[model samples]
Target: MDERIGLRERKKQRTREAISNAAISLFFDNGFDQVSITQIAAAAEVSRRTLFAYFPAKEDLVLHRIADHETESGRVLRERPGAPLATLRAHFLDGLERRDPITGLNDAPEVLALYRLIMDTPTLAASLLRYRENGKQALEEALRDKENLPQLTARLAAAQIMSVQWALSEDNYWRIAGGTSADDAYPAARAAAEQGFDQLAGGLGGFL
Candidate 1:
């Protein structure tokens, strides 16, 4: 039974990757707004229904990874061993220190190209906005366990934290897009993340 589940998961992952690869190729070639899921499915050699199963909407094909980050803030808050704010602050800082791909700390040529693609495309920008909104919601959920932080308060706090991260990501993307190397971007990202986290830690006392 475990073997069967593993096989199924692998197959699902392969399909998703194929779809994403096809979408990116088409997007880079002809632009994101001009591409359709049906065309992507055709390129991927998958049926339209299969494409929908993997990605319900066209944006999901390009922004599939965005969903994972949405759940991460909540996970960090809930599973953090020490102070939540400190944990979050340090977590982001560590990602900066490590030049994590998800944090946009790196300025690899491919990363820059992808970032440029997202920026040049209106659909992608809208998708990114939705992605950030989802991240804020997830952070709010994580803050729910903290005492004295009412729902609105928790949400506002989450918004502030996620907003900072969002801004940092955009800045890093543009810096890389503007010709900065990963080596040069990492220090800037680290410093910016540290500052942002420090501010959140200072102001969000009751929540974290």
Candidate 2:
């Protein structure tokens, strides 16, 4: 029955969350490299086999936290009404207002710690880069399919938009990480995002 299936899915989600939380806590306490699958599995009270079932690789145990957001921009473009760039610009600004971690304008201690962990770990950093590249590809597809853009145009616009987003996020992250409170940095962060999008609009021109 559907009820049984729903319960089974909820149980799986809980198990996955427990394993992820345990892995992150151990990584934060003892460094990512120091933590092992067996140790995380034991902490979560799950077998190593169960852990692998949820997260196929060690890097995934950490990166899975953000996997859902990998195609978020594309999803936004596909679902929201308006010109593609305008929708994306509005979404980024709205994320800033909401202190979304993806915007890199959040100052929560755990958020900052997780960012540091990713930046400090080479393997995780590399994995994140791959995620960003995948995000770009997804956006390209959305542009072509939803917005009716030509293939080359979609590819070019997606690259530009992704680069701008990356630059803006990095700037916001460093500002907050360097001791500026998110509330205090909001004005500059908002301004930077506006400018980044404006520049994108200028570069893409009629296409957007």
Candidate 3:
């Protein structure tokens, strides 16, 4: 039964991946606004009903990738043994070195295009904001659980951490999109990241 469940989950994951790849390719080819759910379904070789079952809307087709990241910070906090803030700081630094898109450090053409697409598209931007909020809540809960802190303290810490993280990424993304090479962008990005994390560590005390 466990094996059967694993296979079913894998199949669902494959379908979601196929659909997301098709949708992103179409979105990048044409504009996000120009792509239709039916077109995405056709590109992915799935029925409209099936596509909708996986993704609720056109915006979700793109932003689900971002939305899916809502748990990542919490996971990092929970899985690592050291201080949560230190762990998170190291995670972002690693992401920067690896050119992870979440760090906005990748200057690849597709990555640049995605940044432009999200900035230019209102629906995607709105959806992304929702995901960011969800991320904050997830982090807050994790902090509360791991620290046995007050709810208000967790909320405040989460807000600060999420804000700094977002600011760091936005700064890097704009620099990269504006023709700064990733290597050239690294110094400023690293500076911003350090400053952001330092601020987070300093402002949110008692938890690490």
Among these predicted structures, which one has the highest TM-score? 2
Look at candidate 1 and give me any clashing residue pairs. Answer: none
- For candidate 3, write residues 16-65 as lDDT tens digits: 99999999999899999898898999999999999999998788888877
Off by over 4 Å in 1: 146-148
lDDT (0 to 1) per candidate: 0.79, 0.94, 0.87
Question: Any idea what lDDT model 3 has?
Answer: 0.87
State the TM-score for model 2: 0.98
- The regions of model 2 sitting more than 4 angstroms off are none
Rank order (by TM-score, best first):
2, 3, 1
Indicate whether candidate 2 or candidate 3 has the larger TM-score: 2
Task: Report how far off residue 114 is in candidate 3 (Å).
Answer: 1.9
Worst 10 residues of 1 by lDDT: 107-116
What lDDT would candidate 1 get against the real structure?
Answer: 0.79
Greater lDDT among 2 and 3 belongs to 2
**In candidate 3, what residue range of length 10 has the lowest lDDT sum?**
199-208
The alpha-carbon deviation from the true structure for residue 89 of candidate 2, after best TM-score superposition, in angstroms, is 0.5
TM-score of 3: 0.91
**Which candidate, 1 or 2, has the higher TM-score?**
2
